[model samples]
Target: MRPYRSVLYIPAARERALEKAQTLPVDAIIFDLEDAVAADEKENARVLLARVLGEADYGGRARIVRVNGLDTPWGAEDIAAFRGAKIDALLIPKVGSAADVEAVARLIPDVPLWAMMETPAGMLNAAEIAAHPRLSGMVMGTNDLAKEIGARFRPDRLPMLTGLQLCLLAARAHRRIAIDGVYNAFKDDEGLRAECRQGRDMGFDGKTLIHPAQLAIANEEFAPSDAEVDLARRQIEAFDAARREGQGVAVVDGRIVENLHAATARQIIARAEAIAERAI
Candidate 1:
């Protein structure tokens, strides 16, 4: 799981979701606790999550748990309860600072952490948070971010671009994979696809998804298109041929090509290949 590009959603306390997890064509599955769970059912959700994690084998898919933030009543119990659970990574919610990250890291030293940047405070200290070695990546929580910042949501996301770019920079500075927030419209496939295109162009590894319908689009958008994969293959082949002929750079289809371009092409091909294997 080299930074999943199509992380899936498995509803908290939903046992059928756990069974679906085994067959879903997703790069990763986030067992959620924050938004999908109701207040009265929090304990029940945790217990079910524990059992699902303890017993289910998610094949090669990642199994991440989106635990409540420390400020919430259930947060501490969420952290402590993972003592014997087999979770791959802990998705800490509303992480405000590096110290907050350190606090969770201290409690669970063995598990990798993906901090959510959903508050103004979280965005301000993103650079510091990214510097943590135990930190695997960042997930933008748009709804919480909007609520915290008192900002209005635009369909074009113009108001949030600067903040999104800031988070992207922090992740890039620390060589971390940055994941975009969900589009929030499960019924609007066009809306979701547009957001997915934006996320991909903006350099996010993937977009955090909410519903099952979003999974295929996320996987398809983030992964290279067939044309891109073909071009990448052509670029690699040309580069190899040039290298064998004692050349530093190669020209394929009249376009200048270098090692950097070839490397990028390889990443594109790799994701496409993964999607292909999953399809089978």
Candidate 2:
């Protein structure tokens, strides 16, 4: 799995934001042309993003462009503008079903696709959407989902739990990355940290950000902690020793360690390595 701890969203229309993004320490950057760019500025945003893709050097960070939906007048043109451009993925907004993935997949060949899981239909058909061959990731669109379901926003995201899990299950089942929704209160570091921890605990690979300030919190929360890494290493060592001794189980910190536990520990260690490598 990719280390997508912090994915920042930058309006594709903002030249300064696009340029400044090269210096930000983010795992990925979503060049948003959907809600972030005004309808009147859609064409200009597309042109600007295409130019940025050609000229800018984002350096190991994944570049994803969120285009307007095909139902909109600007959607086709948005796809057309980025043809052959160097972007890692195309994020389709308001994805309702597998057919929605296919619709965009047909137009953007050789590019991985990401779906926004926001609407009721999208959540209901998440399994099918995730099964699409070209699909690589899913981003939870909690704000739009709240509006669609008339759900009241709570810090715990009690109302959005079902949808979040549904999408996450599908993404994991299909080996695709699942990113948590953005916190609306960008300035509230405590609120953002709480939400990031919740998302990470709930099994989201990462959280999307509306502002760069949220990057540090998201990155810190999603990463494997030093204590966790140390524990994982110890668990792996104990389990390997037990296996060599023809034993099926080992004890770590007075708790039983088995093959399953060792496997999880290895994954944690590998994830930590991946994050470190990306940083360098």
Candidate 3:
């Protein structure tokens, strides 16, 4: 029940951003060595990231490193550099199949693996990728997916729904963490809020963010709200009371609280507790 309310990506090449990231109220930091870094600066970024990761103490925030695809010249070296480094997970880019995960897993057998679900093939084969024993999470790369699929920008994300749902379904079915794609317009706080709400409703564990400005909104939207926590507590209490009375169902605010509802309520309470622990 680790709360992944806001996951921010910081370019590995930018030392200042990397340093600033330690203080941000983000649940996880993806040390991006792929899309964010320029081609010429790849090696330098990888070396700098390895050094920073060794020295920096990011507290409870999960430290994940996004390595370039194995097809690229820097990708293999990128994986090799972080083999023994301290990291929560290794994110493999453009992972289309379980075999892709296996290749990286063979190189770094100990660390958990996360896959970037972006390409069309990746969406189609998401179930297999999510089912991989070493895989721990799935990240939606909407920018790449939209570009590859020729999708136009829409507020409701109508065009991207299929791919998003596909990866989400796979992640959920495999019991893996499912993080939604970034909202490109960092300055549009309202738009970011709307999308975050949408993702949270759709069962994504959290949203991946491109900029620090997007962190607060994401953290707010993904975490359990005060009202939600209150409702969860009431529901759990009602359900327990009913069970003690030899009843199978209970009522909470005009809604029935069945066993399934109680289960969900317990999870909500646990998540809220976990978030509180993170704050402390």
The whole-model lDDT of each prediction reads 0.85, 0.94, 0.95
Residue 182 of model 3 has an lDDT of: 96
Write one digit per residue (lDDT tens) for candidate 3, span 1-280.
Answer: 8889899999999999999999999999999999999999999999999999999999999999999999999988999999988999999999989999999999998789999999999999999999999999999999999999999999999999999999999998999999999999999999999999999999999999999999899999999999999999999999999999999999999999999999999999999899989992
Backbone collisions counted per model: 0, 0, 0
Weakest 10 consecutive residues, lDDT, candidate 3? 271-280
Which one is best on lDDT?
A: 3
- lDDT string for model 2 (1-280, tens) is 5799999999999999999999999999999999999889999999889988999999989999999999999998888777778999999999999999999988989788999999999999999999999999999999999999999878889998999999999999999999999999989999999999999999999999999989999999999999999999999999999999999999999999999999999999999999999982
TM, every model = 0.93, 0.99, 0.99
Question: Worst 10-residue stretch by lDDT in candidate 2?
Answer: 76-85
